[model samples]
Target chain A: EAGVAQSPRYKIIEKRQSVAFWCNPISGHATLYWYQQILGQGPKLLIQFQNNGVVDDSQLPKDRFSAERLKGVDSTLKIQPAKLEDSAVYLCASSLGPEAWETQYFGPGTRLLVL
Target chain B: AQSVSQHNHHVILSEAASLELGCNYSYGGTVNLFWYVQYPGQHLQLLLKYFSGDPLVKGIKGFEAEFIKSKFSFNLRKPSVQWSDTAEYFCAVFSNQGGKLIFGQGTELSVKP
Candidate 1:
């Protein structure tokens, strides 16, 4: 079985520029999540999706950050007008279900740097 | 608000040394705990989890963690560290009511051969 996949392993952009990261979850997984990991910090959940519907996105920066999981298979997280604070790694993970104890599989993550 | 905290930010040790990483959570409810490891250039992988029953949980690669409910702590331990065990470790807790997890600021372990 293939693992969760993410694109553009690394990216660099200037402040105020727009950037997007993509993710393709493991097949048959029902729950998907996006997390932001600043240097020397653990990943912070940005959004979560169950199938094609969003389950939670309370931490997402609505003013600039948006994400979509169309058709319940792939996802895209975008940040318009990126700021220096936005420089971090974006990780995508998938789980077999919504169970609290279910193990989540993660992708290699996209490292973004905003100048 | 639920939050997790790791006592150590970075640790350095020689091979064959014992290891212990501390984690504490602030949620006063039923919860599930997990330890995840991420080696350099690699994705995060589960090391072990504690859902219920036994307070002592054993994970892959000879790692173990003990859950102390009264102390609100879950600490990861390894009897003998290897160079290959060098990585970032994260402690995460999930509330029984919600499936989402709250993670601690990770600890980086570097084991020198």
Candidate 2:
């Protein structure tokens, strides 16, 4: 079984530019999540999806960030008008279900740098 | 809202030394706890987890964590550390109610030979 996969392991963009990252979860996983990890800090949950519907996105910056899990297999996270604060690693994870005890598998993550 | 805390930011020890990393969480309700490890340039991997039954949960690579519900703490420990055990250790929590896992700031461990 393959682990979660993320694209463009590293990215660089100027402030005000837009960037997007992609993720492919483990086979047969039903729950997917996006997280942001600033340097020297642990990951912060940005959004979560159970299949095609969003389960939680309270921490997501609605004004600048948006994400979608089309067809419920692969997902994309986008940030428009990127700011210097957006420089961080974006991680994608997936789990077998939404239950609290389910183990979440994570991807390698995309490291973004905003100039 | 839930928050996890890791007391140690960085630790260094000689190989074969005992190890302990403290983690505390703030959430009154029942929770599912986890300890994830990330080696250099690697993705997060589950070291161990605690759900309901046992307080002392053992994981791969000789890692173990004890979940003390009364104290709201889960600390990772190893009897004898190895150079290969150097990595970033993270503590996370999932509330029984719902949603995503809340993570700690992480502790970076370096083992010397």
Candidate 3:
């Protein structure tokens, strides 16, 4: 009954540096999501995965941001050449399914600060 | 293609006072609404959700929200607030199944005991 888990609760990197965030979903959860929450703003979904396959990533920045959910249990989000605007909290969430009504459980999130 | 707006960015009130936070979503078609709360240094948690049925949905921690179709608004309210209720609240919307959730900026509530 553990909740979603994330690594490196906080991170700091210089501009143009590469940063990676990791997430581990709840046990038996089938759907996973990554969101970016800027200060004073709500979390914006960056990508979503359904059992090792991407369900939606339209909002994800393809030019510099990429994510993968290999084996469908754990996922990683990477931002190459990070910018100042990329400083935000990276949140990972999981749900029982991809249905609209499913309740999503969220992790503590990784707060990234780009210098 | 959905957006949410929160009327208030920050609110402060004494304990036992009534609380209300306004939220509006822009979606013409059928939609689902949600209210999530995040305590200081904690992850976001569901306060309540609306997916048809009753317009007024009650959530945990004595929080409730009413969906007004005409106004396209879902405002969270509490009859009596407490010091423990201090947190940030977010409003989100989903227009389709498996779709990404669109969220508002967020409202930070501070309750002084």
Top candidate (DockQ)? 2
lDDT of 2 by residue, B9-68 (tens): 999999999999999999989888999999998999999999889799999999999999
Candidate 3 global CA lDDT score:
0.94
Give candidate 2 regions above 4 Å deviation: none
Which ranges in model 3 have alpha carbons more than 4 Å from their true place? Answer: none
TM-scores, all models, native as reference = 0.98, 0.98, 0.98
Residue B96 of candidate 3: its Cα lDDT?
84
Clashing pairs in 2: none
lDDT of 2 at B108: 99
Which regions of candidate 1 deviate over 4 angstroms?
Answer: none
* lDDT (Cα, tens digit) per residue for candidate 3, span A17-103: 999999999989999999999998999999999999999998899999999999989999999989999999999999999888999
Lowest-scoring 10 consecutive residues by lDDT in candidate 2 chain A?
A96-105
lDDT (Cα, 0-100) at B6 in candidate 3: 100
Model 3 preserves the real interface contacts to a fraction of 0.78
How would you encode candidate 3's per-residue C-alpha lDDT over B23-84 as one tens digit per residue? 99888888899999999988899999999899999999999999999999999999999999
True contacts kept of 1: 0.81
lDDT of 2 by residue, A56-115 (tens): 999999999999999999999999989999999999999999888789899999999999
lDDT of all predictions, in order shown? 0.95, 0.95, 0.94
Write candidate 1's Cα lDDT for B4-93 as tens digits: 999999999999999999999999899999999999988999999999999999999999999999999999999999999999999999
